[model samples]
Target: MRRFSQFTCIDWSGAKTERPNGIAVATINRDGPPKLISPEPRWSREDIRNWLFHAAKTEQDMLIGFDLSMSLPFHDIGCYFPQWEDSPSRAIDLWHLVDQSSNDDPHLNILSFLEHPQAARHFRHSRDHVGDLFTGGTGRLRVVEQYQRETGQANSASCFNLVGAAQVGKSSLTGMRMLHQLDGAIPIWPFDPIPETGPLIIEIYTTIAALAAGLPKGKSKIRDRVGLEAALQVLGAPSPGPLSQYDDHSTDALITAAWMKNASRDKRLWHPTKLTNEIAQKEGWTFGVF
Candidate 1:
């Protein structure tokens, strides 16, 4: 009986361009611990494609769990009119939106349509777009076909997750704390803590890893898991500092310090929060919030 191979990846952005650096890949073969693959920042799209293609060809029993969006648009655009004056813009510059954190409410953004009612009603499935002969005389069909066939993946558009929005919320909290501590201090709003994302990363990785490991989705069991602790240790996340000021660098510094401590240890760092009563017993800690 041959064992199946399992691959797990965490992608920072679902977009192709940023994926090289943000992607984390881990493979679990039969019985031993999983092997994690660090992101190769220099790996080009072609390089990744070739790697996946070669792996798929060689490993008949491989099962990949990509953090990136694999599905395409639910409906196809019948005829893409690239030259038509009325045609909507197909070239979307999504990079600018990448830095926007997810901790905040996303209903404020135009791209919210991807996850909202408008997209549900008007979005064309990538499958439909590629399955049908593009009628509008656009050459994009070739690109679609080549991408699909070569990648052995779907042709659908990728969507961002809610975590991205939550980062904004975290930043907001950081800013508010700063104002309170500073009393309308000199460098008011001098730093936006929205980008202090190590905590968010830690939380997300914990959740997803638990999900993949068939662990319970709630707080208590997740925080106790050794594997989750190990990943965080690898990430070297800092402890949440005092709610004094909303300092971006301070928050980052706190996490960096924690990472350093964890880095020096033989053991890994566990998920910080929990749903159990144990949290109440812990020093000045509260749970079920944030």
Candidate 2:
């Protein structure tokens, strides 16, 4: 098991704005508390990517986690898009397709593909337009999503659902496009082999990471300075002073980064039995789920 010298977590936003209210980033070294990197104001996805690229060049081996679904459900139909022609047969292929389709989209926005006649066929964009592609129902969960339930965590949203605040469909789509851009630069765990020593990216659910640090469910996002510092202390993180005004997004990223720093030493998270070759190629595994 290779130990990461640094850990980072991003609380991603799917908004199609230059700077979204939901975007936040946090990072921690091996012996320190996680610090909020986007504390001054809201961050954009592009800004986050540039920061990561810079960190990759300057930092030691780091494990970066994004709070978003890496891929859609493929276990049910053996493919993410079952009835669509030229549909991607694997998860990486889907990332490539997203990248290719949204080549003209600035900032990796996914609106271009969302309205495409052929590409949009695979996505259940709304409640009325349910097609052969993935639709959000309790029964059609991906294998990795099932793991979320088995682990006593809240069941994750289907990547196909494109509505509501909890919906991750748009985020996952844009994230795939960005992942394609970063293909050769960073290895995404399970989908790509983690290197012996280097910066790597992984899919993470902040809720799972928060639970691992003994923070009670539904009450983990602490905004007050005292509460935030106490939660960090539980994760063995140093005190984070003076949280005059903070939101859940920053709290989520900070806690997740701290938990990731601690959880990186667990070898079992790297090689899950659920991460079969097929799932690795299609439905990517969520880090720390297994």
Candidate 3:
């Protein structure tokens, strides 16, 4: 298994504009406590991309996880979008498709893709249609999404669900653009094999990392100093204290970084039972779900 000198978790946001409080990043060095890197002024997705490029140039043997779905669910369907001829066949190709279509929108907004006539039919887009959407609806789930539930974590919102607070579709879309830009620069998990050195990005569900750190369901997000301290102690790390329960961005990032840095050692996580070559290329698995 690959050993990392540093572990990082970014609590990402897909909001239209900059999210100062909503986007946060935390890191745990091989010998230290988790620390926040996100500034008070907030960070743009572009900012995060540039930072990763810098890290790729400077850091050695680093593992950075982003809190977003890296690939859309294509396994059960065999293709991300069925019946749509010339739809992207590979995950990387899918990123390019989104990038090409969303060029007119600033910051790579994927709403254009969502509202596009070709994509609108299958995807339920209205707030009024939330109940019929991916997270709670009768829609078919991807293989990894089924695995997410089998592990006792709350069922993850499908990458197709683009509305509501539970929706991860927007973030996933924005992240795909970043993944596209970082291609060949920073290898992404499941989609590509981890390199022996330099920085690598992985898909992360912070709540899953929280569960692995012994947090209870419905309360996995660490918001308070005590809760953060407890989670860190479980991982044999120390707390810098003064963590906020309300600041979900920093709290999720902090707790996730602590737990994931420790959890990365288990070889089972690196090679999941369901991680076949086809799945790796079409529907990459979440990093901690295995």
Candidate 4:
């Protein structure tokens, strides 16, 4: 595996608004604490995509982690969408399908995809409105997510469930749109082989970062400088000092950036015991889940 000079983690959002307050970006390099990079109070999904393109051009080798599922579950059921002729077979194709289906949505929102006649059949839109094709029981789990569950790590919500505060369907779908737009400028790991040079993107679950930083399960969220500094110290990273805000999103990005700086050193993460070539190309593994 190639060494990365810098590490960045994005706490992404899929809110329908033009600029969702949930978006947060943080980065760290070889010798400093992670710092938040905010050009505005809130960021639109397109803003993050543009930032990444510019960073890929200017920054040193970087490992960027987005807190969203890179691809939906495909292996468990033999395909992403069972019995659906239009279901995509690979992660890249899935991204294209999502992007194309939601092209008319502004601010990179995934409303159109959620409402897509064929695509909508797979997602749970609301508490009272479950799609006819929606598979029951927490929807479906990607192979990586199943591994996470078996290992007693944090539990990831199904990319098909969009009904709760903890659900990640919206974020994952929106992220796919951004990934498609990126068009391989920054290679996404597992889906794309690690290049000898340049930045790489990977699916990340912020909870995994928090767990690696020594936080107990179910208590991964850090909301203050004290807690944040403690987690950073556990990861061998110095404190970023004071910040104007200490919300969960900022802290999640900050700690995850620091965690990636250390986690990337483990080559075994690049080849998990459960990940197969097929799973890598279709389901996509989370960076720190191994």
lDDT winner among the candidates? Answer: 4
Pick the TM-score winner. Answer: 4
TM-score for each candidate, following the candidate numbering? 0.31, 0.92, 0.92, 0.97
Order of candidate numbers by TM-score, starting with the best: 4, 3, 2, 1
Note the residue pairs that clash in candidate 4: none
- The 10-residue segment of model 2 with minimum total lDDT is 131-140
Q: Over 4 Å off in model 3, which ranges?
A: 129-138, 243-246
What tens digits encode model 3's per-residue C-alpha lDDT throughout 145-257?
Answer: 88878776546877676667787878888888778877668888888888988988888888887777788878776667777788778878888656544466787888888
Predictions: Cα RMSD each: 20.9, 2.1, 2.3, 1.2
**What is the C-alpha local distance difference test score of candidate 3?**
0.78
Instruction: State the lDDT of candidate 4 residue by residue for 1-290, as single tens digits.
Output: 67888999999997889888899999999998899988855778888999889877875588999999999998887888876789889999999998998889898888887887888888899988898989988999998898888898769989999988899999899999999999988988888888888788998999989988989998889888899999999999999989998999999999999999888989888888888888899999998777
Local error of candidate 3 at residue 222 (angstroms): 2.6
Q: What is candidate 2's CA lDDT for residue 216?
A: 85
Error of 3 at 188 (Å): 0.8
| Runs off by more than 4 Å, candidate 4 | none
Backbone-clash count (model 2)? 0
Best-first order by lDDT: 4, 2, 3, 1
Residue-wise lDDT of candidate 2 within 129-220, one digit each (tens)? 75455454642567989877877765688777776767888888888887887756777888777788778899999888777767787766
**Residue 91 displacement in candidate 1 (angstroms):** 20
